[model samples]
Target: MNFFKTTYTSKLVFTALVIFSSSCSDDYLEEMTYGEISPSEMTSPGNVDRAIIAAYSLLNGQYDASSSAFNSPASNWSFGDVVSDDAYKGGGGTGDQNNIHLMEIFNTNPTIIDIERKWVALYEGVKRTNEAMRLLQNSQEYDVALKENRMGELYFLRGHYYFELKKIYNTIPYIDETAATVNDYAVSHTQYTSEQLWDKIEENFSNAYERLPNDQEEVGRPNKMTAKAYLAKTYIFQGQWQNALDAANEVINSNKYSLLPNFRDVFLPENDNSSEIIFAVQHSVLDGAPDNYNGSIGDRLSAPGGPFYSQYGFHRPSQNLVNAYKTNAIGMPVLDNKNLAEADFVDPRLDHTVGRPGIPYLDLGVLYEASWARDLSTYGPFAPKKRIVSANSPYQIKTWPYISALNYYIIRYADLLLWKAEALVELGDLEGARAVVNQVRGRAKDSQYVMNLEGTTPAASYRIETYNTPWTDQATAREAVRTERRLELALEGHRFFDLVRWGVAAETINAYLEVEKTRRTHLTNANFIEGTHNYFPVPQKYLDYLASTK
Candidate 1:
């Protein structure tokens, strides 16, 4: 989640006395109500709009970072690609390999901050929505559906936040209503077990699906399609295959979104988003906002800000990922053994997976300088990924608050296809899975890899064009889909969770754990078995707080 993606209420810093000066004396620490505007005064039309804006901020920024980072460790990507195991902030420092997060994850890892802030901000949104719903429910100021839609969005968002929260923490103090004091947070937010949370999540998503206006294609908020898609995803996570299939089918049949003609443009800021993106973090440098830090969180992840510029590598693609990029005996990216012609038949998805040295970072900052980022020329050797924008580019070239854009896809149409394929596999309908994976395969052509005709100019030197192999059998088809997903969505917060949800994390991570045990250098002796550390230990402090309070 990019913080600078939108304007927000100024920080409300109260004196230290306020935190510890508990008393009935209201004058001790003057309530610093969010940059001067009190919650009470925000009932006016303009302020309501601002409240809505803040709500949008909550959904995009805080909500996403927490959900993505710790809900699943980045080790999957870092380790999958063999980039950096230590990238896992809590991924134990390999006794042999000095993990960087130990030193880097300080008081400001967005993962931690986002989790805390998302919880509070989401409740703030609930308060505003509750107020708006109450006011509009009784007045003739606006259309009922308009108010209903707004409230419904608020409900869906709360439900979504809870879903994310529950995924991370089993028993949280669920706060559905507006909170007035810290004590109001006493009751457990989640009134049920994971099973109940799933049930409630489905209900809220259903409510959102029914009420969100399909008519408005707003830049930030989730629409009917996304609501359904998200519900479908929740179902996927919970292992509710048929339910997942049902919602996915609804999204596909809706015909509301389609794949962009070109793939890479999907991430381009100028593009806002691909036709396939059902919901995205609305961000623009020109969105009438000043330079913000959240907007540049990835500054250290891309060029100019990364190896291209900095002393530290913000992101590291791993060996599994590099291995995933290798060509096979049949001149393809995947096979029993990739020892074929040593051709470029490697999965075209490689560029999208890991960075090498040749691929171009598509100058995503078209919203700012058209090409402040450059990787296309390939003063070239191996292919380099464009996931991080300012990693190589220097801070001087960027800015303390550089102007970048963020339109993170909370859910996209492509995911629906993936869901459908997964449903097919689970349903024992592998052919259906093949159909879905093949479509995604076709698009990688222009985005990352290009293929050449047999007798074409560059000859065999570099003329080998990307061949979308239309696989025949179901077994091969199932493998194709799995491999495609592993490669395609490599890092966008899916790997670890996917492996866990698929009931494979134990097998996979255990293998890596064993591998690390051997190195015994910097990353040696580190151990992650099937259970212990995979799931959080219910934050001991939270338990301690509960025990004493109870």
Candidate 2:
């Protein structure tokens, strides 16, 4: 028998038979299968709910720790931040998490442990989601609409998993309920073209949007708008401008979500499930959270290590990224400020995003110093801040101070606004696009900057202004939207992908490395070759696994 069949059948027979003779037969109970129940026996609504939760559990991408650096983290900080111009591999040195270091310099290969670990972790999510889907499909206990909704969620999760893989590796295997075992997961990544893969992902989101309810009582559950935003994102990535615009318009016009009053509040623990958040991976600090799977492990690895917290300083921001925040006296970006040491006027969002020297770090009242960095010389003086939780927040996991239950947003409304602006710009609506971009900038304009201990004065020369005049042309609007995304969403793990999709990764990153080399000597070897470095090499173990089976 097949493994699932054999295991399940054995369980059924074991529970049905009794060891005692006919005298004891009268006392024998026709009890339910209490242990090792097969999929057939696991048909109750309660059991199906458990399986659905199991599918959602992998959203945080936590598995029992085996390796550190390349372990599959859902956050994609290493790929999105560390390898991009936004950050450095901020740990000890090149020898530390050497796999990531190689990636930092564009020297990645299939043999790297991070490659293998990331591949395995994401595929594990796929496997779990697929298993849950298979079980749900076989279950008859759920009502029709309820089953469709649950199945839609599985589709979204699967699409998200495949989307990550597609972005990073370009070509990847697509698996679902049809493929249920280890051998089934061994399909080749070359089976589908890149466009074909994106189509498959889009199909999932479309199904999710159609089947999911407009509003869910549970805050964490994805609704129709959630899937629509993701669908818009997928279309945006593919330059399906008209499709992206329509999808974005649907979410925006529905008025289901809006930007938070303060941009900083979006990241805080107390303000979770705010109007801004469309879909976020819900984490919990409550005890017995299944090996802490519900907590964000990425924060622990990237947070301040020595003096600040018992963590590894892995995702430090680069000086180049810090300098990108520089604004002119007019409150517009000082696009060509090569000679300026300190910006005469800087964007307020900068202080919120990066922990610079002498600035007060959050509500801790501690002025951030250069010593906070694990290696100031290698990674530069700045530390990451946007995702860092304040020590005073009650939502922090008590036992694991470093591991936080803070939700990581998969899609937020602000992103929707910006992406809609991008679509408009692409469609020759420069003036129309300017209004949308200015809306985002206006939010940053009103938001408070970092303050002193007494909350009296701003930390840096904080100043930002929205574009008062219409964007003259498409090029200008495009640049404005891109810059706004960099400043507004910096270090929240979307940089590299943005750069790559824009077809400027080589030009932008290569330029960043050159400037970065002068500031920190470690990046002297870093260069972005156009084709080879755009997507990471497929994991070698996959090739080996397929070869062995062949």
Who wins the TM-score comparison? 2
The whole-model lDDT of each prediction reads 0.49, 0.76
User: Residue 402's C-alpha lDDT in candidate 1?
Assistant: 41
Query: How many clashes in candidate 2?
Result: 0
Tens-place lDDT digits, model 1, residues 432-476: 776786666656544434222232332121221333555456566
| RMSD each, Å | 7.5, 8.4
Over all chains combined, what TM-score does candidate 2 have?
0.91
Instruction: Per model, state how many residue pairs clash.
Output: 53, 0
Q: Alpha carbon lDDT of residue 152, candidate 2?
A: 84
Residues 1-550 of candidate 2 have per-residue lDDT tens digits of: 1121112111111222221122322322122343566656676777776666656655666533332422566778888888898889888877888878888888888887667667755676677677778777888777777999888888888888888888888988887778744466667789988888999999988988888888887677788989999999999999999999999999999998988878899998666678999888776664454335456764567776535465567789877777778887778987762633653578888878888878888788788887888877787677888888876676655454366667788788888888999999999988888898888899999998888778899877888889988788778789999988888888877899999999999999988888778887877888899998998888765676677666
Residue 336 alpha-carbon offset, candidate 2, angstroms = 2.8
Residue 504 error for model 2, in Å?
Answer: 0.7
RMSD of 2: 8.4
Cα lDDT for residue 30, model 1?
32
